[model samples]
Target: MSDTPQSVSSHTALDQLRQLIQQQAAQQPLPGERELAERFAVGRREIRRALNVLEEEGRIWRKQGKGTFVGPAAPVQPLMLHDLPQRSNLLEVMEARIQLEPGLARLAALRASGEQIALMKRLLERMQLIALKDGDQHELWDSAFHRAIAEAAGNRLMLGLFDAVDAVRREPGWQHLRELARTADRLHSYDDHHRRLVEYIASRQPQEAATAMREHLLVLQQTLIEAINCGEEEQL
Candidate 1:
């Protein structure tokens, strides 16, 4: 069948979009449909059709609230961050970390560059220096340390999962529980754990790194549980 004029225009739009995508860096967000239509002198409908084809071809992906990005879609559907807190609890979030982070540490040991390892060390130091004075900043650096490990693991899908789990951990309720659990002594111990974990990764000891990560998370899990139980007892 001969291609109709509109269909021909759509095909042209697809080719233009592919070229545009190629010019973008991986994981970079594309301009919105309105902007792209203006740039290419095409209707929004044509741009949308072109984008859909690129998405189906594994050349682009979109997030809810975030715009379309220049990469193949994630292997699974992205987690719904807003709904996670109601559906999950502190213990469940810690358990999820226990399952995910050790493997990330192991991979970091195997795959992380010297620069990445160095950044982890710097972040650990920042956490220690701020731990006594600034709880919020300490938490921020602590999360950054873990995220550095996840990024060093060199697996985008697992990193996305780690981010989703991390988001749940950041909820105010969970943050409050973590703060309640963080005694000075416990903070010192966590610093030691972070040091050892970073050392293991720096030395490329995958098994030891994984073990250290698992043990650290286990301690955090136990501490949070203890704090929660104590809170409940006080309420009685």
Candidate 2:
């Protein structure tokens, strides 16, 4: 049977909506259905249909009371170690990342979809551009790139743990240390690490991905330690 006009329109709307979602930051809320309908010049039914398709693909998630958001829904339970960040120092946070993130990269190599790999590429490019044009925003994009890999690993529990450690890394003192550690030479090295890590994941080489991530984190840890020691010496 020939496809109905409405069904065809809905399919087109679905493609449009997917592109729109790709342009948005992960975890960003989607506009309401009515707003989306207006924006896409489609009926509300068509908008709902497109949203349903996206939800099934894990591109968007809707909460009954809170509207829709980009990316897969997060685990409902918060991390139990709410006070851990306050008590932690930069070294501790690096320790946690070195332990956790390589596993994420390995899993991502094993599990990431083609679309997810493409997103990682886009994020890497964005991070590089930010490093050149807007140095301060580099950390923000860098975090997003790593979070994308963690999400692609398809482990909610591990992602929750990642978020916990990430929260600690975001503390003002930790951010300062990280900023201090990011000399131009180190930034260039980081860019190389990011490229190799993404390539390994894209090529489905789990061990290589894991090794690249571990090496990258170890370098970051060493640099941060140096930054902290330098700060102490200057104060003495």
Best by lDDT: 1
Q: Each candidate's TM vs. the true structure?
A: 0.67, 0.69
Flag regions of model 1 displaced more than 4 Å.
1-80
In the range 1-236, model 1's lDDT, one tens digit per residue, is: 11134443454465467667767778999999999888877778778867765664457999989999998433333333768988999899999999999999999999999877887888888888877675644565677688778878989899879878876776654544675787778889999999999999999999999999999999999999998998788789
Q: Which ranges of candidate 2 are over 4 A from the true structure? A: 1-72, 75-82
Best-performing candidate as measured by TM-score: 2
Can you list the residue pairs that collide in candidate 1? Answer: none
For model 2, state the Cα shift of residue 55 in Å: 15
* Per-residue lDDT of model 2, residues 1-236, tens digit only: 11234443564466467667767888899999999889888788878866754664467988899999999544323244647767878898899899999999999999999988987888788777666453434555576678778988989899878866775676644545665787667778998999998899999999999999999999999998898998888889
Clash count of each predicted structure? 0, 0
